[model samples]
Target: MTAEVCEIVITAPDAEWAADFTRTLVETRLAACGHQTPIRSIYRWDGAVHDNAETRIALHTQLIHADEILRLTNQSHPYKVPCFLVQPILSASPDYGTWIIDCTTRPEAI
Candidate 1:
């Protein structure tokens, strides 16, 4: 069975932006919760390899909100190409799955 929830990963240039973005998603009920962590990113950009310190926020919410989350991130993120990865939760405790659904707003309701 397909899971009813998902985890969306987002990376920001700094902690402040990550916090703000996380808050926005939660406040708007797009995400049930966000866990932030500091991470080092090594990537190739513009024909050059770059290493940078970044803040990663993992947002947990209903799978139904993925598209809206993607749209919002693209619209508000500072980076021209922000990191947004949505991965389905293949399995979760029944209680936790229920909590996620309860915490997030249904798209039709907004």
Candidate 2:
């Protein structure tokens, strides 16, 4: 069976924070992997427009893990309002999809 998966997009103020945040998700089995890239962001907040340099991380993982990922981001992200986007992966190579499922599932806590 093709396991359900998704790509989660998150932005950090810098590469250091992006690396640390991505590592935390992978270490906790919340994501199978994260791809980071430098980006420039322009957006409006608090009735003002702002532009900034940021690091973007695209995380691959099982769909089931999205909620927990959001929870963690809410608790630890540096921005008062962080960017978190979960996009569905409609198709993936069978092996890769299975790998994501395997990497993200963990034994339930006692």
Q: Which candidate is the best by lDDT?
A: 2
By summed lDDT, the worst window of 10 consecutive residues in model 1 runs over 101-110
Q: Per model, state how many residue pairs clash.
A: 0, 0
- What lDDT tens digits, residue by residue, belong to model 1 across residues 14-110? 9998999889889888999999999999999889999999999999998888999899899989999999998998988888888888889656686
Model 2 Cα lDDT, one tens digit per residue, 1-110: 33379999999999998999999999989999999999999999899999999999999998888899999999999999999999999888899888898888886732
Clash pairs detected, candidate 1: none
Relative to the unseen true structure, what is the C-alpha lDDT of residue 58 in candidate 1, on a scale of 0 to 100?
A: 96
Model 1 / residue 102 / CA error / Å: 0.3
TM-score of 2: 0.92
The TM-score values for the models, in the order shown, are 0.92, 0.92
* Predictions in order: lDDT: 0.90, 0.91
